[model samples]
Target: MTVSALTRPGERDRLIVKLAELDWVFILALCLIAGAGGLMLFSIAGSSWTPWAINHVSRFLICLLMLIGLAMIDVRVWFALAYPIYGVGLLLLVAVELVGDTRLGAQRWLSIGGFSFQPSEIMKLGIVLALARLYHGVSAEKARLSWWLLVPALMIFLPVLLVAHQPDLGTAMLILMTGAAIVVLAGLSWKIIGAAVAAFLAIVPPFVMFVMHDYQRQRVLTFLDPESDPSGSGYHILQSMIALGSGGLLGKGYGLGSQSQLNFLPEKQTDFIFATLAEEFGFVGCVSVLILYAAVIFMALRTAYLSHSHFGRLAAAGTTATFTLYVLINGAMVMGLAPVVGVPMPMLSYGGTVMLTVMIGFGLVQSVRVHRYAEVTSGKGSFV
Candidate 1:
């Protein structure tokens, strides 16, 4: 069918048309990355599907179905519910603060009906959707330089402060970067961006020395000099570096990585899974996985570019930014280039919450592609 036919009144609304519009290539990329993750998990778990391997594969399948279901929903429904979703996420964050579970010394999880989850995960998507919705009705000039920017600023910081108080600095930083990306995409002035960067640089030292919790501050110090205490606070980074360096050009061979098999690499199935891949499959495997990630990012951004509605564009782009940050931060941490922030490699790491969050973001991206031609109104009564 031609572009004109796809845009006709009832044509795009057809379920078959929407499914056909879905980016199968992008979907294939996601499947490949998740499969690589499952492969790594299986290898690291003594080739058994009983532990992390099966759960990782099963979760991806479930999240993939959820992604497709969410993709079929109208983008306008997403726009209308944006604020409500964000509102609920914020309230949950507050609830977490008041009576959240304190596991591993972080009060970031909330339990309901015997199921526990980190509310911060919800904010990951909430902030993106809410900010995109806010920017949708505003003009470029106002978005660039105006007193009107305060609304978006508040929308971002309120959650950042709340999450930071939970002491989950990794997620707080992700939320902050994702929100900043949307603001810049919305045309915030360069002058403001530059000033903000300068201020952040100035604030970091003081924040580390005074504001950061002791463990958080120690992670930064350890990243700088992992050799200082190889078996102490720096064990995670030092062991990760060893795994990466030992991997060499090819690898030690599957199920033969000493670092992970000996239980030397910390969080081998979660945060440092990349290092496990590096050890077992070496540089070649790592590069192949990185290529897959790059493809996903490129295709997602292309969807944003193809979107006609401002909400669709910003929503897709903002979600892509969050995913990109996850990959970069996790990659750096694994290689000992950045502080260990516990940011998991999306889809590649065996974590249910992060995997679910990332796939849902992609679902939004696919929805944008499927409804790229649908008209979305601004503000009240917005619809297709």
Candidate 2:
């Protein structure tokens, strides 16, 4: 064997030391947020772990392990797999169209044996990875041109069209917005961006009327005036707003929110989990969770800024943007400021897949944090 082969174990040992140097503050903040979710889920379940709390805790532990494992792997490994992962994610979405589970009136889940998952969720990370790789090889001059822009435009558009076909507009919008963010971060010109935004605005009303499914159109209408159908199509927004406002300053106390404990709030365990927390713990608790989320984003953006590679920078920043959208969309949805979009509040929501996807993204952020000084180039990563 060559000398490099003989010394591979030493290189592995150095990576382990780097793992020990991972940012604990970020990890601890993550745990606190997850812990807060458990408490709220407990309340949402009428103070029983039988339904939600225990599972939330368990899934968080598993995802935490996954996070650390991914963090230990060299960024080059992620770099090499980026496009393939994106390709696989695309295939999974296509497969969903073929034989996906139809649940809650949306065909977004794919079932395998006993396990079911959402491919759109995977695309959230896949888009970030793929676009990061694309832009890593791009120059600012190329990024500025219209023809060269087709590369990223198609990368962002294709999955978006598929996900929207699933009629999962929530996740579709997420992918679209996050992908655009990566394109912007890739050094797109303001002239191009402005024209694009104008084009989107110009087409939105017609698109909503013609292109949106009936339920999708209804959601927009409901957002504009939830009272229009308070007992029917607007029930979720109405109940969530009631729960949110009733909490007052100090809240009704845990397990005692009338809207939730009485079973008026829809999907409280998942999409409306933030409202569950707010109803039980009031304004103070909501602010606390937001602060935790802000800290995570701040650290992630900081990690991106310190990264030596463009992939690391864009990947971290894109992941951060997706997460920020999760918070904004969910927070607004529950407050009746926007349409109900079924976005979970990171670890705070009781869905296993969403939690797993978020942790996987963080694992990449942690990779950037641990190896921020490490440099990699197009088509190759430095071994040491």
Which candidate number has the best lDDT?
1
Q: Largest TM-score belongs to which candidate?
A: 1
User: For residues 177-270, could you state the per-residue lDDT of candidate 2 as single tens digits?
Assistant: 9999999988889999999999999999999899999988999998998889989999999999889998888889988898888899999889
Q: List the residue pairs that clash in candidate 2.
A: none
Question: What is candidate 2's TM-score against the reference?
Answer: 0.95
Root-mean-square deviation (CA) per prediction: 4.0, 2.6
In model 1, residue pairs whose N, Cα or C atoms come closer than 3 Å (at least 3 residues apart or on different chains), thus clashing, are none
Residues 82-192, candidate 1, lDDT per residue (tens digit)?
999899999999999999999888899999999999989999999999999999999989999998888998999999999999998999999999999999999999999
TM-score of 1: 0.96
Q: List residue ranges in candidate 1 displaced over 4 A.
A: 1-13
lDDT of 1 at 39: 92
Which residue window of length 10 is worst by lDDT in model 2?
A: 375-384
